[model samples]
Target chain A: MTTSAIAEALRLHPGPVDLASIETDAAPGFDGKKADGQTALADLGSELSDLQERLWAERTAGSERRVLVVLQGMDTSGKGGVLRHTIGLVDPQGVRITSFKAPTDEERAHDFLWRIEKGLPPAGYIGVFDRSHYEDVLIARVRGFAEPDEIERRYGAINEFEARLVDEGVSIIKCMLHISADEQKARLAERLANPDKHWKYNPCDIDERAFWPAYREAYETALERTSTQIAPWHVVPSDKKWFRNLAVGQLLLDTLRGLDLQWPAADFDVEAETARLIGEAPVQ
Target chain B: MTTSAIAEALRLHPGPVDLASIETDAAPGFDGKKADGQTALADLGSELSDLQERLWAERTAGSERRVLVVLQGMDTSGKGGVLRHTIGLVDPQGVRITSFKAPTDEERAHDFLWRIEKGLPPAGYIGVFDRSHYEDVLIARVRGFAEPDEIERRYGAINEFEARLVDEGVSIIKCMLHISADEQKARLAERLANPDKHWKYNPCDIDERAFWPAYREAYETALERTSTQIAPWHVVPSDKKWFRNLAVGQLLLDTLRGLDLQWPAADFDVEAETARLIGEAPVQ
Candidate 1:
């Protein structure tokens, strides 16, 4: 079967996005850019752009409703590209994106939730958590930030936290940006191979590979435990970066469209301003 | 003399919510509610929700504008809180926030702008740079990320980068979250006093103290050279967390309100759906 067909079947079935299944058999390396490929991407971007505009409006009018997106993935899973593409499509004012870094002394001082809560999005706004509170349960769980009970407590806390936010009108959209192990290794190797990309890697990241199973368990546990009615998980296939971007872009656009945003009635003299600015519709 | 006075001035100045001056001393201690004393945090949260909604609609409408918020300050300054509160007021769908961590091997590989550009918010979105491209110039100038020419080159790149973002409809809002040196000690001491907080303290944080003077010089240079018409720095006095939250909240509210967001015309079926779900509005 073609990669897309295989991807579709996996998505339709209730299973994880298998890291081993991605086929990376293409003959290596680049020219500049493929004309058709670039055009296809451009076309997709334009189509997504139209939807993004509408979504932006819905976000404003549905001001009562907001979207919270949680992106989780192995390193080099196109999180940045997904973020970049998302940015390319929407109005920056309505959007807020966060890439969680190592906890600060201040952040460590408080419970993880304290820092995460501090970043909660207001109504009618879109907030993206590049790595989210899930870290507390995922990394912290394996790293031993707390005991099993504590981890269990946080899993419940996460659900309740998201539920409350949703009930209060926040739409929590969780995405597991999935990429294959080989794919990740390839990406990591690229970073190592290219001096320019070296800054993105950390020796610690390689060290963390030893604990991949532990982290996978942690992620699975958190995902299983926290995936609830308020915020369901979309294990987005990320083997193909372009398709991943398109899928997410479409999802966001669809959600925003569903919001039914509208401008409020003018509190000021709109007729005067329109006439002044556009100078009388030319008697049309 | 008081930070509140600046806040008062920001309020009095014509615009959206008053862009108040926030002295650290005037910031509210953790009272467990809205940092702005007049409004319960719950209320502010609700208000933020409203603002978020409107801003989002405007964003999705193809305005394709972006907002850059820069927060700089002394250690233990209110930068984290500002980040938290700002994100607190918006939806998470269209935003990404990145706090510059110690350069990773991969990151150190590329030019400074490489990682930074990776974090910039997309179109019609808001990206909050906790510590941003400023680091190349700030830390390089202070900690020496590169040689002198590199630092100087970064400044030009910064100006150009920001200009590019602005030219592409990015509206930059920069703030220096100011805190007193004494406050830093008090906070540090507080952390030290608590055993639970011990892990939070990195000896490196104190090590940075040795370079405080150097860091200050770097910051001054950054402010002088990099702060421009497109991205002027707002020096916020964050001695008081509440006042800081209040002032910044006003700043954001004011900025967004000026954007004049409105919902699109409601669709014909919106009422039908509303009635289908909420059983129609009361007679009115």
Candidate 2:
């Protein structure tokens, strides 16, 4: 399949999105087994690295184009895993990663998008947000952390903020890692079984599980209200970790390829510089 | 050889250091050809990943420990290469990399270390500075950006600053990537020869070549003054890119291993959390 077609297959179409209708275990567009998916991801690594370098190179030539990947998921939906396995493919030098946690007193004092605006990648970079301004709509709505009218207003605000970013040359990729409740339970159990993973376990994760339906509704409503043509959301199945990594990797690869980034032309005379370098004396 | 022993061999001892005496192309501690070094580096990737995760895990349990790698070198010394090939082995999410360029007007207004201070990694991060506060001594001295007495004071100030950081649980790995004048010319020529590499080619780099001897002397003096017991410097040969990558990777591995990090124990009852997760109802 063509790269864009593969991306389109994973992309959530505009309108209402039903959480229950999607199969969390199915590898939607990929025609492969676990090993094949791994091999494909490995191949995508080199391609992604090369494309990212071009994107970075353009920045050096004063281009403002950049990519922002916003990953949102419930606890144990493998947001961290995608960062490690998929985003890990490129040069960390060219990537800016921000994992947004609970709002600080200062962050709460500002507009929801204020901290996010500060975290945007500069010219020629890929920025990843493990959780983002979406949290204000996701967790905030579920937990009733904001006023009902305020929560209702944020959806339009987020859409406008994103549209402005797109106009300013930011390509945004939003992925909602979709996993079954059974899969989350199994993953949580594995974390409990492994002593080394104890640091990742939070009792609050269990507390959050009680509000799963509410969170799902929030996600569904958010996806419907905010999945714009400019910045669409891709609901990645996360029951199979390999598929999640592969899908996101492919999506990034397609986005980069779509940009058609070229090696920035030399503004200086290459011949003159080469001659000057050749004529320079070696240090004694 | 033990990892520490390999690290020890690459370290610059406290004494007068001569740039001319060191072979820029030699793989000092590693007994390997290019392919062998590549294999060895690939092996370090997984090991480094595991160690970094453990360090990251420590932060969740309130450990303040972190690692800072300071990279300093002349132009075309492969600092970016090490970041891509060596540091890229670990999860980018866990690594904080800052590439310092010439200071802005605001930065010039304050002490040099002020900018460096702001870039320090928080708990659980492996921070890599492509160029660091060392620039104040090296470039500032060569270019006369600061007064003689002011430059002299920075060395002592740097020692005290680094010592304080060590006391606060930051392990410093400082490396000066050493490359020969001939090697730099070749790399610069290659950049000029390739259109794709034009973005990386800077005319100022050629201008900087004229100050080689001055810069070398500045490096020697800075090394003599600031190579403290709390934060020593390693002079890694960089003409051979593979060895440079391998040596830095090994140095980072050794520093992480020295920390003796263990996964933090669970603060909550794992069994109870598991039971609660298992009993949670599936969202309709």
Candidate 3:
């Protein structure tokens, strides 16, 4: 499939989002097998690198436009994996990635978006949030960490906040790495079985598995309420890791292409600079 | 040559230094043409990635150790190049990079090390400084940005600060990317020649080229005064971008290998976690 189609295919339409109906293992809008998808993703790297440099250059020229990728999913849904394989393709200098953890006392004292605003990328950057504001809605709603009225208020607050970001030239790509409960079980089993991966296996992950249905319902509600025209969520089927990487890579590429970035024009006379450099005496 | 030997060969000894004598185009320890060096660097990627992961995992197990790479160079000397090619080999998530620009009013208000301390990576991270506290001695002396006594004081202060960090488990890899005056002129010319690269060119870079001799003398003094037993400097011959990348890559690999990082043992019962995961009911 064409790269642009990948975004349209994976983007959650406005309305109810029945994540259970989505196939976790399916490579939507992608042709061929896993190897082909990997190859295609690799092919996209150079173009992504060039476009990202253009975006970075534009920042030097006073453009405030930037891209923010928000990734959300259950544990072992391959958030880190996507970060390494997909986002890793770009120059790390131009990318700002934040992996938000549980809020500190200081952060908890302020509005949830305060910490998030601090993490936003400046002009000419591709900002990545490994997990972001959605958690305040997802886990907070699933575990009853907040009141129902507070949770309801957050949905609107988030929508308006995102809308304002979009208005200010921040292009946000929100992705839910959709994976199956069975897949999560298998991944957890693998982590438990491997001595090398022991650091990754947390016991709380098992406790969270008990709330799978509630988490799924929370995701559905979050997706339905906040997946707006300005900033939509893409339900990336992540059972196949390669496809997940490819889908996100294509989404980023399309978003950058949509901007049609150009190299910033030089603010100085090239000839004058070249002559000045040539005339400079060599150091003894 | 062994990677360990790469570090030894490039390491500036504890004595007087001569920047003019070093051949910028020569690959001192690496025995290969450009293609071979490129392949060698590429080959180190997986091992670098594995070691970096282990270092990251050890942090979760309460290990306070981390790695810091400090890169210094003249304009067009490839500090950014090393960042993109060499340091970019590792996972960006585990790396914290800071590019020190001209000091802001806030930074200049306090002692020089204040900003450097703020940028230090936490446990389990690999911190990269594009330019660092040495600037207090380098530019501050060359351009009369600070008093001679203050510049002299900074050299001692920097040594003590770095020694303390080393005492606390931060391994410092301080590299000064060395390039010839002829090569700087060539690179500056190229930047002026290529419209796409104009963003990287600054008219002030041309002005800085006039102070070449003073800057080299300043670098020599800085290297002589501050190459501590704990954090010795390595002069990376950076005229050949490929060798510069390879030398820094090998330096990083050798340092990470020296740490002998191992995955942290599980703090939870694996069997119980597996059993709990297997027993969880699947989501409907």
Candidate 4:
């Protein structure tokens, strides 16, 4: 498609993300691009497929490495797309994806990470948390999931928590899927339109929407304070999903390249122990 | 790096597979051009991480779409890498990874798909089976997961089972991870020599080593009888893990892309139904 046609297609698509910013500018607060409509869906699908195979190898190899991909975004900011694109790439076993909603009664009683930690993948595994412990800092503060002082203290705790994970050999990559106000309303409205999809919508979303500025403040504070050298945050422009997905895909490739893991020394042997790990698990 | 060095590095770093001989080659084939050894640990590790991302995407998206990935392979043929790759790329919530071995008495009872289907991912999820129902046709014909005549019946039943899934909108991708006897022996020996790794060494694996040809025959027969249009079989090159990972990643990407699932479209009056779907489940 021609550039103008692509721009028009993007206009049909909701959200106003400028992806070029992801690749080039990170400073002036991501001047997001418009979606290329037809191209966005077509390309995201292809890239997702290619990435899937690489991730499967890591799962099968059962190497002593772990990858944690955390996505923190505002409502209707393309967290679902980020998830869809992220899974669009890999095999099912080594990659574990979680979308966090309201905490279970049990979850509320325990330390924030208590429920979150159970979901962390083992070595050579990748875990994606749609909304992770950062919720304790963001939603908890905005929705009163925790006390103000508690929310304030969790920032350091969040940093320490992530630092511990990185130190323990888990590669942590955090993404804040950023979208515009108009985009959020459009998405929330879209969810309100379909029947089969009706299952995904919740009225509480409106309540959350009312506190957008509060959430923004909570998010900004959570992000700035918890964002550390160990786990840097990427505020992805979700208005243009194609760009967001491409950006995420690129980031994954870059980080994977940087990790540089290998099959355990050929002579060192991995089969038995790896097999044993599976064997010892209560065989279903 | 020199051509040889590059070749050595490529050997260890898993990438695209040569599809033509994927059915025949066994081993996580190295791409690194190392004259002294196979792919380096660093390259392989990085490759695994990349593979993991791809696989994670597929797991999450495919699962949401209710896709099942079936991986079958001989000893030391690198099924593990497939697992690693597969899991690494999926959302863990939607990705269910299962490895089938000797069935327990309870599993032996009831139809094969009973246990197998239990492992089936919920609608809108991804399921990965390391060894699957085909065992009724494969090993049952060989070591007998069922009666001799039952094995004959199962081959057809297996075809229908997969066919039914496809008919019901389930996407099935079956792969036979092929490895060479030589590579298998080397890996087997490596596991045996390492004290820590000894636990992974299975005496049963050696017992099957003697019947490699028979197992091959069973695989061929099973493939011919059961490889339906809906769930076509891909014999991946086991030796070249890079290629295997690449091939699988591509295949998964292509598979999910083929489904073309749109985010369930927005539902305007979903609050009531959303509550019901979750409410139907018993609280723990």
Candidate 5:
């Protein structure tokens, strides 16, 4: 069967994602023209809305199907921007967004995936995780938040958890918003330069930036270990904010359309009901 | 403060909503021209999209504000269409939609508002209820599903519940999508005539149609008892589907625009960060 060109170009096939081999500035689906790319994004936005409506209807009619978009990016990689500009194009009514910050004392008490399981989107809904369980492996590994043995066990736990979610009808689109150290510096600098952007600036972000090399190594390890056949990780280049948005949007649109969703069919009689309704006296 | 013209025209003020006084086919927010009205609806759709983003950003920045849209109407009154076309214009990532079906055994075990409280949109989100707790008063009363005394207490409970939500920063927009019996008949007939719409056809809907007068009386009683300063009811004339969509869209836009939301300001230093980023070596 013929598939969407954009999905075919961007999808990371089953295997390891070599972070160094991926370009952070690639716009494979767009012409060089900015306006043309934006127009394409707009068009895809409307299609995503339509497909989402059908998906909701399918679920309402008793179909247990769902889409979960896992966004993992370093600080200042524009996860919030993607949430606002790209996926934000679909209706908010049908989407469930979870922004996982540091686990609370109560949350930390449970097993790592405990908080995550509570936030999964129900069948027929689109769920977005601004930061997700992968944080367990990424930040925990890089920050020495967990022991080396515990980190290894988490990798195994995550794989088992995701495989079960897939078995239960969740279609996962995991995108690591990949940006270079230089790009990160520019973004953080921009945040400091603009007073309006200061609210997003945390002094600790600089502390994390100091560990750039270590974090990159941590990400490369995590991607290689977790990119499975059921839920492969797409390393989205984040140097060009616009391209990152477009690629992720197209990835989602393709995944939803691939479901071949249909507007649910009616279950009751038409002709007799029509005749009865027309023949009946006005309720007024 | 001046309110929006469309909002002013469509809002049902403090009084018992006499459904008979409302015109199910009225399009007060549109010009007489259908094409013009459709164009106007499209414009409002985009505006809703922009405002919704800002509202979400406001919430993400720690504003505890929210909007809840309650849609209560007879079957075939176009609740699903509103969800798909009007509200669907906003990004799904920020929306929380709940379509209340009959009470499941577990739900029946709890108070009526138990399920509703679980579905509310958090700060900065817009929550849409296709059908809501008012059913406890409407269907339960008309179909004798609950005792008259129990139904009466629910009205007081609903008023208190809504008042608390408002006090906690949830703005409520309750709308009764009013369609004439003839309009409903035609819609049901159209559903039957189209094979693709078959799944939406529920024979029980026709059985409920037989008790039209009781349902109307029940709705009037519910509206009169629940309409308060904090949560007013807007009886929308929904015989014309396009008009219905436009009216709801306009109401939401006006409500959100009235908030006078501001983009959050940055908290970190700009000049220093810019200098540091520009001076930094490439991590590649």
Candidate 6:
């Protein structure tokens, strides 16, 4: 399949989704050759950087546009790797990475999206939320953090919030890094086995893992209810780490490419400015 | 003098600043050779773009640093041109431009800095404000829009506001686009002479021109009272537009260069991911 078709396949349709129907280990656009896939990923990375530079430039010279990438995944699903390997390929200054931990005291004082509002990438930026407001629906739902009615309200709130950002020149890319429960178990085991990764191991993560079935249900509801046309959710088959990185990277490239970005034309007389600068003293 | 030294010379010292002591027409670094100065300006533009890209990149991989360029000037002192020529060189996605006009009724309802706070640049962005919070003191003071006591409160409020932003990782570059009264009159006349430029001319601008001395006094006070070490004001001579662009461009380059930015090292095993990708099937 073409990479764009593969990217399109990753997005979840706007309705109830049976997570079982999507294969977590599938690498849809690959040719079963790692070297070629790696090479293709690298080429896409360069193209992504070039497009990002123009998008960044377009904010001042052309229409000021912005992008936000929201990644929601179960623990140990390689969210960090996707960020470092895929999104990390671009210039760091152009990307805003917000790994939303538990809400701070100040953040808890306001509406959930108040902090999200603060986190929205300004015009021309590509913002990444390591774990985003979906937590309000996911963990918040699975753990009974908010009432069902309140959780229902959040779906509408999230849809409206995303629509508002889209209205204000932000393009949202939402992805769920889908990995099988068996794969997650093995990954957790590896993290524990490697002494170097002991620091990354959280006891609460294992406890959270116990509720995997419930968490999957929560994700299904959140995805189905909140996937609007403006900001749809893409359920990326992420059991194979490399495929996950390539898919997310391709998704980002395509999103930025879709922006009608142009390097702004000079509004003044460049010839006159050139002549005048050379003729005059460097003014202070 | 070297271009850097000339750029440094434009910065106004924090204290009692007498506007007459500063020459608005002197081109400090130019050698009466438009070609060489233009070449140097072009070089600065490229350097600025490189540094800004790294700075934008650094936000995720490195320190997540950000810069704000605040331009304050008299009518026709070339703030827009500086934004277009000097700042225009960087990728627009990396730059956020906020041109502050007269506050709307809703804006007037809030504390002055409330609006300013809303416009602060996010990490990794180079934000430009054509006319900024300084307007509160400049036009407000000249027009008696605020009581003397309230204006006194604002001086302290602005200093605190700037200090808070610096603390939050934003480096502010404030410039007063300094042009002489005669230059202003000539620019206004030229605006009228060209029918194409008529849309940019406001009758209120001509009326405000009548209070030039009051405006100068107001500026001198604003510069002296609010030029914090964290956000000092640079008074760029604007009689020559080319020099103004070059000076501001050089200043931005120097500022971003000072940021200790580096590309982020990957936190995951690259070799393993590469191996896994090459070996996996193109799972559909």
* Residue-level lDDT tens digits of model 4 in A1-284: 11222122222122333332332212122233445433444454454433433443444455446778888777666666766555545555456677687889988888888888888877766678888888888777877867888887887777888888888878887777777655766666665555434445666766566677777667666666765656767666567676666556555655665665432333323565445433432211
Docking class of 5: acceptable
TM-score list, all predictions: 0.46, 0.98, 0.98, 0.55, 0.90, 0.54
Interface RMSD of each: 28.7, 1.3, 1.2, 11.6, 3.2, 11.9
Using DockQ as the yardstick, the better of models 1 and 6 is: 6
Candidate 2 lDDT, B1-284, residue by residue in tens: 24565577778888998988989999988888999999999999888999999999999999999999999999999999999999999999899998899999999899899999999999999999999999999899999989999999999999999999999999999999999988988898899988989999999998888889999999999988988777898999999999999999999998998899899999998888878877777744
Error of 3 at B163 (Å): 0.6
**Candidates 4 and 6, the one with greater DockQ:** 4
Model 6 lDDT per residue over B150-216, tens place: 9999999999988988888888888899998778776866765554454445556555766888998
What does candidate 1's lDDT look like per residue over A52-151, in tens digits? Answer: 3444444434446777777888778777777755544454544666668779999989887888887776665677788888888888888887788888
Q: In terms of DockQ, which candidate is stronger, 2 or 3?
A: 2
Q: For each candidate, what's the DockQ? A: 0.02, 0.79, 0.74, 0.11, 0.47, 0.04
| Tens-digit per-residue lDDT, A1-284, candidate 6 | 22286677887776788898889999875666566667778889767877777777666555658899999999989888787568757765566777788899999889889898888777778898989999999999999988999999999999998998889898888999999877876786676555444445555655576688888889889999998888889999999888888889888887877885665554555455334434443222
Q: Tell me the tens digit of each residue's lDDT in model 1 across B1-284.
A: 22333333422221222112334464433343433354643355555545555555555445676666666676677676665554545555545677787789999888888998888877656567877777777767787658999888878888898898888877676676666655666666665555433433444555565676676667666776776765666656666676666666655555555555565332234333323323322211
lDDT of each: 0.60, 0.91, 0.91, 0.61, 0.83, 0.78
Candidate 1 displacement at residue B240 in angstroms: 45
Instruction: State the lDDT of candidate 3 residue by residue for B128-226, as single tens digits.
Output: 998999888989898999998888888889989999999999999999999998898888888999999999999999788879999999999999999
Question: What value of lDDT does candidate 1 attain over all alpha carbons?
Answer: 0.60
Number of backbone clashes in candidate 6: 24
Candidate 3 or 4, higher DockQ?
3
Selected candidate, larger lDDT, 2 vs 5: 2
Q: Which parts of model 6 have CA positions greater than 4 angstroms off?
A: A1-284, B1-3, B62-64
Q: Which parts of model 2 are misplaced by more than 4 Å?
A: B1-3, B281-284
DockQ of 2: 0.79
Q: Over the stretch A1-284, how does candidate 5's per-residue lDDT look in tens digits?
A: 23456556666776655677878777765666567667777888778988887898797578999999999999989888888778768776677888899999999999999999999999988899999999999889988889999999998899999999999989999999988877887787777776655666777876678788888889888988888888888888788888888878888987897789998865445667766666666565
